[model samples]
Target chain A: MATILKVEGLWKNFGGLTAVSDYFLELPEGEIYGLIGPNGAGKTTVFNLISGVLKPSKGRILFQGIDITWFRPDQIAALGLTRTFQNLRLFPSLTVEMNLRIAYHTHARSGFLAALLSTPSFFREEKEIGQKVDRILELFEMSDFREEIASSLPYGWQRKLDIARALVCEPQVLLLDEPSAGMNTKEAEDLAVLIRRIHEEFRLTMMVVEHRMPFVMGLASRIQVLDYGSVIAFGTPEEIRNNQKVIEAYLGVGDLIA
Target chain B: MKQGIRAEWYFLLGGLLLFGGAFLATQFLNRYLLYILVLMGIYSIATVSLNLTNGYAGLFSLGHAAFMAIGAYTSTLLTFPLALREAYELPMLPAFLGGPNFVWPFFPAICMGGVLASVAALLIGAPVLRLRGHYLSVASLGFVVIVTTLAKTMKGLTRGPMGISAIPSYTNIYWTYLWLLITVYVIWRIVNSRFGRAMMALREDETAAQVLGVYPMKYKLMSFVVGAFFAGVAGGLYAHFTKAIRPFEFSFFLTFQIVVMLILGGMGTTAGPIVGAVSLLTLRYALKPLEEHLKIYGLIEIIYAVLLIVVMLFKPEGLVGQKRGVKKITVGGKSSA
Candidate 1:
């Protein structure tokens, strides 16, 4: 598979504290890559840097072989790189449908003047956006909550809506920040199945920043373990499971064989 | 089905009530009451327009009064041939502006004023809308100060601190209500549209808004310009109603009064600004005698400031906030219990 995203020599610092240090990764197109780390391991920070939320102090990020290190968040999003926040950042006042509609704004061609005049083309585009929103909501099984305000949705549904919104952007590479952080075991299992289904259905490349061992091991074809803002291990799940260093990192033992 | 009575219907009904009340007051009340009502109606437009920015879009702009000044001066200069005759000692204004004897009708002049103000807003909003939060507030405040200074300094055009007087008294209760209805309709339609949804989205989370393809700068400028247009219409009516125009009339205090009305009623709600304007104006008129007796220059200001502080402390969401409707769900032949 062709590489969809490439990050090399990435460094981000927050006033003498290195958040992500010399991080390097290559994500193949249409693959689910898992990023695992303990708390404060810079996994989410790496996602932030790649998604253009935080600028890297020193690095090169290429999306589809085009350098996007300096692109703004919106610009990067327009180039089909979208991410969900660790803490849900849904628009509370807007309905679930409206929240998803916002992601289609890039696809909308109507200007303010056109909308004011109620032009036929504007109406057509609006109808198209409505249909697109319906499709995404149905895909996530969130159609019943379409008119409900995002904040009013239950916790699991809120996470589903967030991912649904990100999907509306039609991104090539989706960065999910802890997709099942707050779910129960059953919900986590369901999410794992859903993630695999979504990756296949959308033909998407995904980098999931997660700490849940079961979910990551079950879902990810390849795993990259981050320690102290650096990639300590990169291998398949079986190889990673057998790595002595990986075992020590998780179990805090110097001599452990899996 | 009963929930079909959307918020827009409330706005329309409320506007009708205001119109009916304005008409009734004109028939039974004295000229002073009529004057106050007219002023209230005009200020209501400004307050409502300001709410579109400060309330719905979550932008705080202190320079709205500058747009009012622009409309007032533009209409005054265009219509008041007396100024052309006295200040420039010329018989007429430009031919396109109807010249010396060209007295365009009041409605068109008001519209012209609104258009002019919108144009000015577009110019200023382009650069100012780039600044967010406190920066936007400071930039807009600076704009107001600049416009006020220009009005005072440009003596030949604006008649300086003396102001322009002898404007035609063409605005009456009927015309005021008509304009108010139009303003209310325009604002109501805007807030219910997709653009309004995007604006609220921007207010909630700008980064998410941008990622979703809602350009914050463009929408912010659009709201600013539209809001300025209505504010200009209000200014035009004020100019014609008083048969006089002055720079100080659209001062920082005027901006503050409008802001108070918006906050008091509820910022984002369509009825909030109108409710705020009518309530505060009535209270001010009622307290005028007491204010004179106490020798306080701005008794209303003290009241307004205190009210704002109290409201911010206890009910920062205001009287009418953006509330979500509850939904009932059913699953497996029973309510999801």
Candidate 2:
């Protein structure tokens, strides 16, 4: 399979501390890639670098062979790569539907003048986008609370909305930072199943950062283990489970019970 | 669809009746009432325009008066008589600018004022908008101080401390009333569009806004320019109505008053600023005559402070703010409740 993302020798320095160093990644098209690490192992920083929130100090990032080392975050998103925060980041005061619509900003084809004047094309596109969002909301079982303020939604629903928001822009690559962070074990299992379904339904690549070993192991086709700003091991779930450095980094024998 | 049409018709009819009443007042009412009405109209422009940045985009700028001053001076330098221009030593400008007046008409002068103010905002917004929260406010306040000092020192164009007196009383009910309507309409249209939602996203969380593909700097600069443009126009109207221009008139106090109007009316909504501006100005006007006999300084401003405190204590969101909250959330839904 062709690679959708290629990161070569990526490094980030925050003054004295080196957060991430010499990180390399190659994610194949339509495959799920998992990045696992202990606390403060720089998984989120790597996501930030790829999303263009932080410029890599020394590295090259290629999305489909186009260098995006210094592109702005919005520009990177417009180029069809988007992400969700580890902590939920929804437009708090906006309604759930409006939150989804704003995520669809890049897809809004109506020009500014047209929208201001409420022209025919603007309304037509708006109605079509509305229909599309309605379908997604129903798919995610968020149809019952579309009018609720995003801030007021139940925690699990907010997490679902964050994932839904990441997909509305039709991104080719989706980076999910700790999607199962606050989920109960049952919810995490459901999320693992939902992610499997999503991987089957959508023709896109995914990179997920998760600390929950079982969730990551079951969902990802390939896994990379990071310890203290470096990739310690990379392999299939069974291989990574037995890797010596990965076990030692996680502070115990590899407990693969789940 | 039917509901939208009904609302539009009601808005048109209400506008016509209000305009009719204003026309009658100009022809037959007392000067004091007309003066108060005109003042409210000008402030409506200032507060409503300021809402674009300070409220919707969450910029919290404290230099709105600086933009107003730019508009006032730009319009004044253009239309002040040739004799007045010759009196000031305006060597900094081109020879033609210092020699004869541009002598443009009323509307053109006001437009030029808005244009020049927007230009200044464009130059300043790029650097200043990077700072967030109180840092942004202080930076903007510094801008106001700079503009004020320049006006006091520029002796040539501004006539130094002696400001340009004898400016024509060209701004009447027509000019102010029309500008107020235009300001409200333009802001209303933009705030209801996709661009407005993008702005609110930036206010919610800028990092998330970027991940969602809303560029912060582009929309921030746009709102800043729009707000400054209207502030400049309002300043021009005030200069003509008062028949004088002074550096002290466009001071920190003026910016404070407009900012108060925005917060008291509920910062994010179109109706909040209009409601806030008119009621506050009316209260101040009613108290103006009591100052000399009461012998207390800034009694009117004290009353405003109390009202703001009361709003913060009880209905902290202002009277119209929750309505704005409802505006974005419940669009196109059949359930009204």
Q: What are the models' TM-scores?
A: 0.85, 0.92
The parts of candidate 1 lying over 4 Å away from their true place are A13-18, A119-127, A248-258, B1-30, B82-84, B87-112, B119-127, B289-297, B322-337
Identify the candidate with maximal TM-score.
2
Overall lDDT per candidate, in order of appearance: 0.82, 0.85
Every model: Cα RMSD to truth: 5.3, 5.0
Give the range of the ten consecutive residues with the poorest summed lDDT in model 2 chain B. Answer: B328-337
**lDDT string, candidate 1, A69-104, tens digits:** 998877888889999877778897778888888777
For candidate 1 chain B, the 10 contiguous residues with the lowest summed lDDT are B328-337
Which runs of model 2 end up more than 4 angstroms from their true locations? A252-258, B1-14, B82-102, B323-337
How good is model 1 by TM-score? Answer: 0.85
> Clash number for every model?
0, 0
DockQ of each: 0.26, 0.33
Model 1, residue B244: distance off in Å is 2.1
